[model samples]
Target: MPNPKIFDLTPPDLSDYIAYPILIVSHDAGGASVLAAWVERHLDVGQCDFLLEGPALRYFSGLKIEDSQRHSRTSLVPSEVSRFACVITSTSGEDVSLEREYIQQCRLLAVKVLSMLDHWVNYVPRFCIDGRLCWPDLLMVNDVYAQQLLVAIPGAPPSLLFDNYYLQQQVAQVLQYRKSSALESTQILSRRILYVSEPSTDSRYNEFELLERFLNSIFNYDYFNTQQLQVRVRLHPREKLGKYDELMFHTFSEYSINYCKNELYHSLAWSNTVVGAQTTPMVIALYAGIEVYSCLPEVVEKMTLPFDKIRRIY
Candidate 1:
């Protein structure tokens, strides 16, 4: 489905197309963030009439369900949705079979399912972000972002996409950073560090083991022991792992974590590293200049990386 490269935007290109309320879907929080930013810009450029996005597609990495639900603009379906983008995207959880089924229902009503949004198509989206006057079939992006995307969809091309990793990353970052009113005293990634996991292989608990170990290693500073330290851990959104009273690890794999805090580029900058298995975070971390480590031991040794630096992947 790869098309010859075309660099210029033409009027004839968009004449037959209509934004027709887009519904964005994905397990990637960062992917949602990119869409939000793109939509706002697209609206400003008068691209589509109105883009209708679902709840999970717009959520940031961190936050409580209650807080996110309270925002009317962010809510997926309040009362009416004329047209939307239905993205059946996710890396960890099995594809939302229900959401995929709903795609046709929404499309029958005029919503569009944008399958390709290769963020790494040509270049990183400069916040000088502009609107997509015409919906992109194979949205061109940068090689950097493209590298990250390959992890999520191995065969995926930088210009050819099946999901939005940008929004997913955004949601993850927001959820990781946002503090709910619950005031639960749990220490989280305060340092310039990154938490990594390999969802394509290990189970949720296995990731938890490494996460707890990582946290204990970092939090138990000069004066603290593992027991004395309080850590904030954002588990893989794909891992609806069991509850963690034993550790302050936040389980976000089951339900989408709430919160739309910042753009993917900005938040990624804060993390010292990007951790994942066959997931896209590693590529993103590299693009954002954050170090990346593959938690999936099996793949770590086999995959090629641009930099010599490699993760344990175990």
Candidate 2:
């Protein structure tokens, strides 16, 4: 998939963000919403500002969290930094280079930095960039598994770790929402399958090759030939389908191939199985009680995903 053509890559105005005492920064929709929910519950007015990246900001445009879902005092913005209090950010460890500018600004401002774990991978590089370790004052992990993995990093201190109550609650709430929506669906003919696609720019794996392998796995399956399922491809927020246009046009003529625009929770609700490689949506799928399968190449096993059994496609 190609990147978005119309996104505003420019950094948002940070003045509004600095007005609040606490700042919450997130680059992904899941992390931003989770942080937003947390801010709404714990922080008071003038206490916190929720800052999101361009992709995350656009993805949350129409979705409204109920008054009850948020605290009375919370500000949501598109940028961040400052000296008032603390700055909290989440990272899955994949895009450390991209966040350097923001992180640097926070450092220069001497803002207390708190980093939240997005998933159980890239432990060392996620926090330790440019040979500097313990970049954040506080590091939050979602579960015991994350804690274990993070603490094992050579020089990472144990005292810096804390449980991510906000993420835990978000996971529970998302699961409940998906579970409730399942009863409302009336479509009974086509068993839906969600294919969560990631960008191929990363040096670790080729998205095109992995996609080909996944397609071959499904086409060779005798049950898939029965045409009892519908395949819905959900592109990563930062990804576009331009690269897959040719392949999609040439194949799956007998079956339905849809590009999902709804949120991942909704996508999980509409699907029976989720396929991906080291993606957080797979974790969300499992939380929503949907089956998940791994489609990563053999050399990509370095990805330390949180799943217990990520069944390989081939």
* Winning candidate number (lDDT): 2
Q: What is the C-alpha RMSD of each candidate to the true structure, in Å?
A: 11.5, 10.1
Q: Tell me the lDDT of model 1 at 176.
A: 53
lDDT of each: 0.38, 0.59
For residues 278-307, what per-residue lDDT tens digits would candidate 1 score against the true structure?
A: 444566556444556654444335553344
lDDT per residue for candidate 2 within 177-214, as digits (tens), equals 65687633644556667899877646867877777667
* Candidate 2 local Cα displacement, residue 95, angstroms: 4.9
Which portions of model 2 show Cα errors greater than 4 Å?
1-20, 58-82, 92-99, 105-110, 128-134, 157-190, 201-204, 221-226, 241-243
Report the C-alpha displacement of residue 200, candidate 2, in angstroms.
Answer: 3.9
